[model samples]
Target: MQTTPEHDERMAKMTFASVYPHYVSKVERKGRTKEELHAVIFWLTGFDDQALQRLIDEKATFQDFFDQSNLNANAHLITGVICGYRIEEISNPLTQKVRYLDKLVDELAKGRKMEKILRA
Candidate 1:
């Protein structure tokens, strides 16, 4: 396996809602706005605030949330290192997607202008 078996055990069962607040908190702590965080999320997941809220409200798992939402056509454009793992190189599809969001949020937290985060 290109990634470790533990990677599956690590994130296969994580809930989108469970990790979402941390994303928000991390960016907000960096003096970034919630709207910027939401923008990156929407850019990747194709969910507006309401749909995302519904999924979070229902406590959707990462798999469930992604299975239902349309991944952005441009999400592949987001590529970088996050938490020491290259976003484009993570072999597990789910973890890669999750980390893609993480990278976007990290960029937002670092104040990497929203346009660049959105790949605009």
Candidate 2:
């Protein structure tokens, strides 16, 4: 999947609140807990339960959400393919960050050990 500027723009406009439930459901359906999902999210974005709830309430766009994040230094360690894009090779920083989150959730759903998934 080639990520054109149009695709990036669409992704940037996506609301965190909109996709959050699907993330929760994806993990939960695979027997992962919401706390585990939260852990993954926290590791990537530094947003806790309260802050996440606030973002959901405000319906923050992905751009706004990531712009406010203190992205983890280890986020660079998140390398792999997500949504058909290789995380490390992605040139768009925000899109890479989004894929990083997706990849983390995928790992969680696959029952990967938390230590490895968080690149600990």
Candidate 3:
């Protein structure tokens, strides 16, 4: 998907903490636990619960959040569409990383097994 400068700027400016609760709600409403959400996050971004909480507390933007992460090598295995953009085809590195997390959360909420979600 083509990454527009404006969209990239907007996403980069958006705080992770602002959207975190929505992610929690999405997974929980699907009967998934917050632990499960954290597991997915850990698999994709290598942040444990404590680090994640710290990031949230810091009000880090999407840019800052990914900047501090050691993105999993297997993150490339996350493919498909999210928010109308194909994950593998996104041109912006930061935007792609954000969508990678989004796709992982989506898979978890959709009842995909953890092993598959983590690409294990």
Candidate 4:
């Protein structure tokens, strides 16, 4: 069946509105700072003032914002899987303390095995 452009537009708008609510609330509430809130929203929905204001009214959390965002579910799932793997790969107190990417690279250059480098 052929779908009209109007039908497609309506469907897209509905989807965006439905999904937007969840993210808005989370970022509004749980984001401790303006930048933090903006960053999360920017990552999720680009930047829309009306949507952002709605989220502020509702208050939101990081997970909530992520759950509601327009990001593809399968993509999010795949990313979650990869993140889990990365976390497992780098699950060491010493490695956790390395806040900078450069520090991580430097540690990697020490000629140490993955396990040893992560531990250090």
Q: Pick the candidate with the highest TM-score.
A: 3
Which lDDT values do the candidates have, in the order given? 0.85, 0.93, 0.95, 0.36
| lDDT per residue (tens digit) for residues 40-64 in model 1 | 8888989999999999999988888
Question: For this target, which candidate reaches the highest lDDT against the unseen true structure?
Answer: 3
Cα lDDT of model 4 by residue, 1-120, tens digit: 233455433433333335444434543454333344344334334446666666556654333433455542222211111212332233332222111122223333333343432332
The backbone clash count of each candidate, in order, is 0, 0, 0, 8
1-120: candidate 2 lDDT, tens digit per residue: 558898889889999999999999999999999999999999999998899999999999999999989999999999878888988988888888899999999999999999999899
Q: How does residue 23 of candidate 2 score in lDDT?
A: 96
TM-score of 1: 0.92
RMSD of each: 1.5, 0.9, 0.6, 16.1
- For 1-120, candidate 3 gives per-residue lDDT tens digits of 588999999999999999999999999999999999999989888899889999999999999999999999999999999999999999999999999999999999999999899898
Residue 7's lDDT within candidate 1 is 73
Error of 4 at 84 (Å): 15
Kindly indicate the candidate among 1 and 4 with the higher lDDT: 1
Q: Candidate 2: global Cα-lDDT? A: 0.93
lDDT, candidate 1, equals 0.85
